[model samples]
Target: MSYVSSVFQRIKVRNANEPEFLQAVEEVFKSLEPVLEKHPEYISANILERITEPERQIIFRVSWVDDQGVLQINRGFRIQFNGALGPYKGGLRFHPSVYIGIIKFLGFEQIFKNALTGLPIGSGKGGSDFDPKGKSDGEVMRFCQSFMTELYRHIGPDVDVPAGDIGVGGREIGYLYGQYRRIKGVFENGVLTGKGLSYGGSLVRTQATGYGLIYFVDEMLKHNNKVLQGKTVVISGSGNVAIYACQKATALGAKVIAMSDSNGYIYDENGIDLPLVRQLKEVERKRIRSYLNFHPEAQYIEGCKNIWSIKCDIALPCATQNDISLENAKTLVANGVIAVGEGANMPCTNEAINYFLENKILLAPAKAANAGGVATSALEMSQNSMRYYWTFEEIETKLKNIMVTIHSNAAAASSEYGFGYNLVAGANIAGFKKVADAMMAQGNY
Candidate 1:
């Protein structure tokens, strides 16, 4: 068997129950065959094996009191996967679906995604099984305090820095940072990235991921002699990523017709109202179905998956992992989706990705496409370290340049390996080679 296959087989056996992690490992390993062939020393040195396993995995029980004064227990996890280039850097997700396997998968993906940013950050991911939905401010704050009470010890400014993911956002970050400050008794702004603006948060950080996804997609279209103007875009999820993707895509002249939440989706044939979406999701924290109250002319779908069936020129899966299955891919292709840019990690399943590739749909993989969040997080880290801040224009300009460069790097790697714009393999190879080289140079830890 080839070295890539051998390493994957071992990972499969060891992580048999961790289907998500195994899937992530398999996806990354499939593109690494060429690298393994080029550098035999990597296999001999067991770099792949070492990189597959995390440096530390912390699982602890978080007990906090809800508004009812009853003690509730939730399991929290932190997977400090790799720190070869610099300190461990990633996000913390808080949701009911969070588990060790999920955390491991996210952390594993982060290793490559962070490398693709061309930054000096490593990979890590953490989260809890506690669902933040419907939780009061006091309850959420208490839970965050409990979560940070344990996480603060394992992280530092120059050590492991975490931002926000699915369930964790600006509010959660503030609570976690506040707790960390209270516990440490020192002001360490660099310990976290998604802080409030008054307390050293970076501008454009909230819109970074969504804006970056569109920027990368714009680059992809440019490569094909196309542009975002007049394109009908359908984006899944109405959270930070989806909302901002809609905002940016609209500013770029695309008509975003649909966006969703866990409950359902809203379709506005005249183009989604970005302000109303921001109000419903960010301010009111209401379901997407509520969008109909304002835009009565728009259609509301009862199921989120059916949002894929809506015909559009572009599809951005900004929701959760494995949302686009084989059937969904078939529906999208049948409806003539010209391009797909994943705003969420591993949103497309392996079968779905194969269908898209076979149908010749232009795809921007998550690592390269949705890397704007972490890339901006890294920029935030730089500003925090210097005790300085950049204006929105300055930060956004840097972000655009970075996204363009990432596209070029991925395209170059694909062409070099004869993939010819196969960004999946391109991003994997490009990201893995950097981490592999760094690992080799550092020797065994």
Candidate 2:
């Protein structure tokens, strides 16, 4: 192998414990192989290693009192990976699956995702092992308050900005921001994003990720002189991202035939009723199987993986990481999928990604495609700083523009490297150049 490849292999060996993080770095490096060979300065700087490792990692205890007056504690973490562009910005996830490895991987991906937004935001990710799934509202509030009690000390307007991820949403943000406000009495709106509308949340913050996923896919289609109109689509995960993706697909004249949750997937050969989906998932907090009760024509499969076999023109994996594997990807390609936009972080495996790329499918990586969430969070921060709230239409328009700009930037980057229409190369080269230039200016750290 060449020297650049050798350096990456060494770094991968040294950081073998973080499979997801290594997978992310490998994808970018493979796409940048040509550039690395041309620029010996990059190899000499060892920029890849510096860029991969977080500058600061903070892990703390979050002990809270439940409604039973029982005491519980969970681990919380914040990995500030890089700040070459601006202040550290990312989401805080609260789920049982969280750990140091997951946090680091998310943080590393956030670095490039934020960079693609073309917004002045850095990279970080944090959250707790505090599962809010079955807890009472009171219990969740107490846990969020307790979690933010310590987190508030570490975050501020200029220091680090945290938003919502997996298990953290409007409810969690409300509790956390309330506690932060009560403790500091400053009412700094930019400190936390994904807040309630009245409390300074951006109008489209809730819809950004899913809508942006569609926007990116639309761009991918347009790149090939195609569009989403009259296309059949299948989306995994019926949470915020999945629900919104369904809505946007319908709005774009695409028939979203299927949507799934952790338990299973619901397929309606006819277009999915996003309104009913919102009722089942958002208001009722139930599984996707229940949707069959409303629409008997819809079929419910008992596993998420089965959704991939459904024939479709486009697919958006908006669920958790590694939800799609080689087997599923092969099935998708065989079924004639033209494009995929990842709404969830690292939703597909390395093998699956290569399969898609090699097949000439339009693959929009999570860092470049699903950046709508963080980009809207940054907008929320701006609104918070100004103590002003924007209308839903206004925020939605701005969000659309941001996604279009990101698509243009990635496309331009791909063309610059003579890898026209290759989004992976575009994102890696564009994101890496920004962070590397900043690090060079800062000297070290």
Candidate 3:
């Protein structure tokens, strides 16, 4: 084991509260065990421990008035993990599922994900427990303004930047940015991302995660002597990532037959209707099962995991962590699933990941495969800094190029490290080397 790993094992035993954070860190280190052992300098610099811990964690209370004039309070957090490359960069999630553990896990993953983008952006994550799902527009706005009331004090154009995640979307960003501007009294456009097009949002930011996933999968298919020209695809999650993934995959000539949500999924043999689905999801804010009402040909299943068992040539798990298990991995492989690209953080558990690796299935970890979202966020920051916005074509072209470079770099790192086509190893080693070298150059902080 590497000396840094040895040090981490000791710290992990003493810090039991940070299980999610530790798990995220462990996965990255597991693939880099050999590299760390071969390079003692990284251990001497304690890069492992430093990378595991955040540079700062801000936990505060978000108190706001509801539409009924009642006061509601929730916890908010911003875990600025690392800034070796640039300012802290990541999304701010607003869901009932959010907490310190979830934020820490996401923030830790952001460190390497941002690094993979080859951009000068660092890693950070923040959010609150205020659920916007059932709340009214006025209620949502009040809560977002309160969340930003405290969050704005910590973030700036060149400091920690937050974007949209889960319940935090264009509407939430609008409210948050409004409050930040109201308080700061300046149009700090870059401090928050996923903004409306009228403001500073990039053209393709909404589609980056899904499009990037396909781009990485396209590269993987090329390596396997295949293509997405007419492949059957199954995607999990009906949120921004999964919906856009379906859109991009369909646009690229693939037939996406199935998609899932937190409740269940729908399978359409005639290929999912992207326009209809987007209308239902983005405009209507409805569930996947509701798609059947408009299209009687579609079938809705109650359980979400059933989507994984559906036969497909490509499987993209664009949902939450550990959503894909060992059994699901085996099922996909047995069903001739050639590739699996993660669009979520740690979507596959370690066992599930090892199953894909052992079976020689082409796999792209979330950090590398889904770096497009944050990379585009960094692009938004650039536009904000320069006081100019990029055209739709310009932003999309940049996102595609970044995803392609990330795929190639990860492949090259895997080949150089004797793992050949093992992208997990490649992504970990390549990202680690950049951060590790930076840490080494800066000396112990």
Per-candidate TM equals: 0.99, 0.97, 0.97
Flag regions of model 3 displaced more than 4 Å: 1-5
TM-score of 1: 0.99
Write one digit per residue (lDDT tens) for candidate 1, span 319-379.
9999899999999999999999999999999889989989999999999999999999999
lDDT of 2 at 188: 87
Best by TM-score: 1
Model 2, span 15-85: residue lDDT tens: 88888778777777877776776666777788878887789999999998888898998999988889888
C-alpha RMSD of each candidate structure in angstroms: 0.8, 1.4, 1.3
Model 1 clashing residue pairs (backbone)? none
lDDT of 1 at 366: 94
After superposing candidate 1 on the true structure, give the runs of residues whose Cα lies further than 4 Å from its correct spot: none
List lDDT for all candidates, in order: 0.93, 0.88, 0.88
- Give the Å error, residue 352, model 2: 0.7
Distance from true position, residue 421, model 3, in Å?
A: 1.0
Clash counts per candidate, in order, are 0, 0, 0
Residue 207 displacement (Å), model 3:
1.0
User: Tens digits of per-residue lDDT for model 3 on 1-445?
Assistant: 6465686787688557877677777778777767876787877777888887789999999998887889998999999989898899999988888889889899888888999999998889988888898789999998988888888889998888899988888999999999999999998798888899888888889998998889888888887798998999999998889988898888899999999888999999999988888888899898878898888988999999889989999899998888999999999999999889999888998889999999988898999998889988888888888988788799888999998899889999888878888999899888988877887887777
